[model samples]
Target: MFVLAVILSLVTAAVFAAAGLAKVQGAKQMRDAAAHLGIPWDNYRLIGVAELVAAAALVIGIWLGWLGVLAALCLTLLMIGALVLHNRAHDTVQAMAPAIGVGVLALVTLLVRIAA
Candidate 1:
């Protein structure tokens, strides 16, 4: 279970880190998506930094159980927030799919850690 949790955490971190980097890079797609979601363009970099921090914490948590658990929990919350934003914006499945997927993965990792 621990091994599986670690693998999941790593995968989640990678996905989110890429997303964070894209936001920081001001990728056109990400900017447009954020705008569509009603998020201010000025906050894009901040969101990206948050994601980067969460990603780092998640990977570090592999060695420190508490850190790992905390990061998983935070990621789960972030995903939940994403769902809410998508719902509020009445976004299409295509827009919400990534959030749903990442949220589920984060929830799984968090649950597995709790079980352990």
Candidate 2:
């Protein structure tokens, strides 16, 4: 269970880190992507930064146990919001994929952590 939790945490963090980096470092591309999801570019940089921080927290939280749970919860919410924004933009495919994927991972991480 502990091993599962660690693997899940790492995977989740990596995915989010990549996504966040893309958004933060690749602003123009991210803005275009956000436009597809109906998110204005105005605060995208901030969002990206938050994502990066959250990703880091997830990794750090793994050692702290409870912090890992909190990080997972935060990421789950972020995924939800992203899904909502995508849906609002009529980007059903894009919205559903990451939302569902990340949500499932977050849930799994939560379950494993609790079990451990």
Candidate 3:
């Protein structure tokens, strides 16, 4: 269970870190997507920062059970928000897949850690 949790945590951190950096670096697609979602530019960047922090917390929390639990929960909530934003933007299911998948993984990790 611990090994599984670690794998999931690392994967989630990698994905979120990449995505957060892309948004922070002003990737055009991210910008356009945020605009399409009716989110302000500043808020969009803020989301990137949040993702990065969440990612870091997830990775760090692996060594700190309480933090891991908290980060996973937070990431799950953020993914829920992402799903809502994508829905509002009327994005294709393909575009929303990552958030859905990641959100589920986050939930699983949180549950696993708690069960441990």
Error of 2 at 51 (Å): 1.5
Question: How do the residues 41-70 of candidate 2 rate in per-residue lDDT, one tens digit apiece?
Answer: 757777788878878888997788888888
Clashing pairs in 1: 61-68
Between prediction 2 and prediction 3, the one with superior lDDT is 3
Runs in model 1 deviating more than 4 A are: none
Q: Against the hidden reference, what TM-scores do the models get?
A: 0.93, 0.86, 0.90
List the candidates ranked by TM-score, beginning with the highest: 1, 3, 2
**Model 1 lDDT tens row, 15-76:** 88999999999999989988888999778678888889988998998888888888889889
Please give the lDDT score at residue 100 for candidate 3.
Answer: 89
Q: Candidates' lDDT values, in order?
A: 0.87, 0.79, 0.86
lDDT of 3: 0.86
Better of 1 and 3 by lDDT: 1
Tens-place lDDT per residue, model 3, 14-100, is: 888888898899999889978888999889998899889988998998899788888888888988998998898888999899788
| Candidate 3 TM-score over all chains jointly | 0.90
